[model samples]
Target: MSVAKIALVGCGPPSRRWHGPTLTELSKRGAIEFVALCDLDETLAAQCGEAYGVPHFTSVDEMLDRHPEIMAVDIVTGDPSHHVLAKAIAERGKHVMVEKPMAITLAGCDVIIDACQRNGVHFEVAENYFRMPKQRAVIDLIEKGILGDIVRVRYVDAKAQRPFEQTARIRGLTRPFSKFGNSSGMCMDMGSHRLSQLRLFAQSEPIQISATVKRYRHSDEFISEDWAHATIEFESGAVGLYETSRLGESLAHYQITGTQGGICDHQWSHPAIPLRLQMGEEWKDVPIEFERHKVDGVDVLSRIVVHTDPQIVYVNPFREYAIDDWCVGHAAEIMSLADAALNKKEPEYGLGGRKDVEMAMAIYESSLNGSMPVKLPIAETTSYERILHEDYEARFGRPIDAK
Candidate 1:
């Protein structure tokens, strides 16, 4: 079988923890081969390349030239650079799987979608939550009319302690790839997962998004929002509430209600934990458990080997529990991508080229503009594209071809 050549951009944590291993495993399985590793930092490029046994390049153009058969680009760049790199990939006629919040702003997202559409290339927002076993099970329940008509949803993704204080510095280790703060805030950083999942659960497009964003203290290190709570009105008449913060340490929680019954999942728990039926009597936690396998071969006994003695075996994917998080849904996304690559069937995750960045922009715009209820399905000509085109032309002193 011919190997699918891929260029990996942004050597961040996701790249190291998720994309890197997945690609390596795919390479071992003859699914795809890493042709190049690109990063702004020469050392990181060299390190990642050496680790993966792929060539390292500080310049993407050079990598493309050396390996013109590149079929895909794995992009994990920060928000500001996402569009620029994605646009380049689209122009080059390469499939792209990008990490969310698709683009920093609405217009940036439009440019990406338009370019991909015109280029006839596949674009997928690497949203893993939608593919999680428990989450998928809940979605299945909802789809089967088990929950009946969806009425309301409350999603709270809170941490027990301040995230910035604990994880910000560690996260900033990848700052060289892009402006860390550009997409580091709770709003775009973590909120995207919740919002995207909400849309999937509702199985309908949102009509309007009203958001309230704030930063209690100023930090030059990061420029993105720290805390945000958003309200969304779906076209199906489902009202949703989403709250996120770099500070919430109590619990990572989720709850959804319908006319018939309700479902809930708490921190470090399974979506199949319990199903409560609103019978004539009362709501009770029905004992339902689904065997959730952590895809990265993680188990209770593996902890000592991975943490206490790292040199004894391969790296443990569950160091911070994010291993289970990514492993929870990685197979779904990978299988989906593989199917699209081989069978020519559109996968649910951007298989038809859904404009996720457009949705993201709508959320950002709603937040930026005083939380006014902004309509969904924003036009392709968003303000960022308009304003940026002008700025680009002015800066270059020539008409710019954004397409």
Candidate 2:
């Protein structure tokens, strides 16, 4: 293939922040050709494509027809439209790379997966977090036996407010709904990354999820959340404690504890301890290129990795770009995908993305059912959105979408 031709579908914030820059970088590397762009909004498609000197279209069908040489379409549409847009491209026998969380519902994910299978095309999701250089190194330590018999993992992601909280506020809603406009709410929105991290480190299929997802204090809704927390039981006899929110104080902490060793994120350890690993007989900092930059004496390394264990760390792609959390894993994701596309390789993120959505759904299910434990593969006739809609009607005496 002479530089696999690719089209980008959906020009949203994420598309601009991560996808566009990464794809452009790949094009510069001569790994792929930016053939065309498509979007429901002509203005968005035109602006995005013109910026790259590529053709633009308002419809996927039109773009596909015009660019018959296109080898892949990267779909970054909203959660609700993910299944529809991806299935459309897959049915045309083109490989697809979808943005994270896969879909708003399991059925939607199933449809996209089945479509790709029937059409004989590759299907992958843009799951970036677990792909980070530091994160990958940490996971390797756990997976290799350095961690020694995994026991449990703890992860917390709390954002005081969400992108959509203000939009919901403007609507005069008595309660906050997702700004992502998905029925899965922030649980799936942010929960996708949390669960992916847990699954990656724990290396287990979840057996059960016990948790709660609530919307409280409509007036103070930041990004949108009262609170969300879950405890997951893994099939491998391991456990994970997970929490996330778009309300109240920004904090993130993650750690994987095992019989012999442990690794944690910056937030999980003490100030005296390095953010990487302070393990073994003596707590020495992991040997990283190791530079810390801060504002007002507070540590903030735009994006630096500690070479805690050189054997596990490989050459990181994010460093070449502006290294920060925003650009880190995302650049790695596209870089790996570009290589995979050129080599005719399927990606590692396909089934895992769908499972991430499923695990998030399980967390929401537990919350909806009075904080009881919900078993995996949740055999419920109820969809996650149905519960949210019911709650909305009860709170406002009308359906959630009522205007």
Candidate 3:
């Protein structure tokens, strides 16, 4: 098979650490022919392009005009730039792979997805949590029915100084990008991962959602919400309680209880040991190894399943190819998108990113609405709760998110 030609936009922190390493690994393995690196910052673009032995351009339009051979693009730009760049690429009849939260708003996501469909181009969202080998194992156990009917799902991710730094990333208060105009901040950015994990594990559509967004007092003027506590009720009648940052010490834990038994994992973000599984009254400490796999001389991390038991399965991002601490499964996710565009294999998240954004947006809507449970198929286009924006404007005497 001929190597697929790929291009990258945004040579910032995320691309440099998360997506860039994976794309480089793909080029090394001959799975992709990375054509060019594009960014608004000419210096950064040239630096990244030179590192990979590829050409770099400050403008995406100039690069595209010069290289018609580029078959796909990975948009690593900020939330505001996603729709614009994706639309431009889709217009040229090329597949697009965008970072999560797809776009800041449901309307933006709609436009991007619609354009991809209109242009007959593959549009894939980069969401890596559920793709992690350990998380995939939980999915397999749930599917095998050994865990019986899922009764309740509880997940927590707490951290100290989270609101401080993450808000910087969202409001563009830091380097790489600035003031992204995402007023929802941590509740939407990191909250999306929590919701996606719940949604994937439930294997059912969210029927109702209610949340309490921790306030700006815990954060600075840069962001509005510091954390989020959300509950989602699935169509399968299962409940998910997701407790995010609470302005405290760093901590992460997950547990799923079913009719028969339960399981828990302390290390959900990165590779760790002692993934406890229960089928009876006692806990079974099942050892899980994080490693790479091959299918007939082909590196197929997406196809390789981690066996949780005699009949249970899971998948972790390959450790052999990881470039960053948080990006263990990034390359695997990238490869999945490549398959969707080049090999006719559908991406697991395909367009579900729109739904993820919708759900994340709903959390803010719920919090400002007295934590009233918002149902799925949310009708709002703007991301944050209207009340929160009103509060911010009243406090600062100016509109924070004037996008």
Candidate 4:
């Protein structure tokens, strides 16, 4: 079996923590040829290259020109660079996979989509939450009709600042939040993932959104909202409520309600919290099992099974590579690109990433307009996007669409 030849751009924290190791492991397993690494920061690029034992370059054009064998590129850079990098890589006739939110703006996402289309290359967004074992199991159960018709989905997160501050302190970063640039506040950052999950859980497309976004703390230094609440109405008649805060006590709640049954969990991604299901006026603990095996001294999840009347199962395709559950999402993303590049197949989540961004943009647009409801399939450049575009031009001294 032939493997896809792949390279990576961006040697930032995400690369070092997740993408680098996952790519190296995939290469060792003969899944893909991890060819090179690139970053504007030469030192960071060199460090990542040395760690992954791959050639490195400080320039994207130089890397692509030198390593023409690279069939695909995984972009793990900041949100602002996604569009520019993806377009350039696709124009070079290589498949592209970008990190979540696809791009900071709808216009940016369209730039990527148009470039890939003109170049006849595949494009994928690395939205990994729904690919996890537990998430997969839940989706499988939903598909099997165990949950019946989805009626409502809710995700609440509180005290997000605790972890954010801890990570910032450890990294020794003192920069305040910016209105536009590397980060677009909590809504677009983590909210993108949650919005995608909510859509998937409800098994519907968002039609309307009403939201309020506010900043309670760091008013002097933070230009973006630290608290956000949104109510979404989906095409399937399902409703979703999302609330998040960077302040307050730590708390998490995720629940999916359906016509016949529902699921509730207190924490996100904690497998120890057994999924509880309500059926026939009784709420009971659903037996959840994780199949595992030892590989390279690591206990890797092989599959996850949810005990319903008819069993629902999610078997990890990369279990043989010894990828743990946490990195399983990353492995799946890489393999998704490999499959798209080598087999000429569409990615598992091709344009779905754009939909996630659209949802987030709706939330922001609604918030910006005094919590007025916003409709889907946004027809024009949003006011929120216009402000970001102006900010981009002011900071970069170039129009966002400039080549």
lDDT of each: 0.63, 0.70, 0.70, 0.84
- For candidate 4, give the lDDT: 0.84
Model 3: residue 299 alpha-carbon error in angstroms: 15
TM-score of 3: 0.82
Candidate 1 residues 23-56, lDDT tens each?
6666655655666778888988899888988888
Q: Which stretches of candidate 1 lie over 4 Å from their true place?
A: 1-3, 163-184, 248-251, 268-272, 292-325, 351-360, 367-370, 380-403
* Tens-digit per-residue lDDT, 1-403, candidate 2: 5777788888989888778776776676565677788888988888998887788899889888888888888888877667777888888888888887887667667778889889878788888878755566567667777667778988888754544454333221122343435434566777788899899889888999988776654553243445778899999899999987565566687878777656666463222223334365654445544344544343433434444444544444444343454455666666555555667677778888888988987776666667778888666534555654565467547543332
- What TM-score does each of the candidates earn? 0.78, 0.80, 0.82, 0.94
Task: Single out the weakest 10-residue window by summed lDDT for candidate 4.
Answer: 167-176
Better candidate number, 2 or 4, judged by lDDT: 4
Worst 10 residues of 2 by lDDT: 167-176
Tens-place lDDT per residue, model 4, 1-403, is: 8899999999887788889999999999898999999999988988889999999999999999999999999999989889989998999999999998799889999989999999999999988889877788887777777777999999987644543443221111122234455666777788888898999999889999999887655444666676789999999999999998776566678899877677778867877435566766887788888888988987788878778777777888888886788788899899999999999999999789999889888888887788899999888898888888887888778777776
Q: What is the full ranking by TM-score, best candidate first?
A: 4, 3, 2, 1
lDDT of 3 at 32: 72
Stretches > 4 Å off in candidate 2: 162-183, 219-225, 267-284, 290-311, 317-328, 335-343, 379-403
Error at 347, model 1, angstroms: 4.1
CA error at residue 103 for candidate 3, angstroms: 1.0
Q: Please give the lDDT score at residue 152 for candidate 3.
A: 88
Task: Please give the lDDT score at residue 121 for candidate 2.
Answer: 81
By lDDT, the best candidate is: 4
Report the error of model 3 at residue 218, Å.
Answer: 7.2
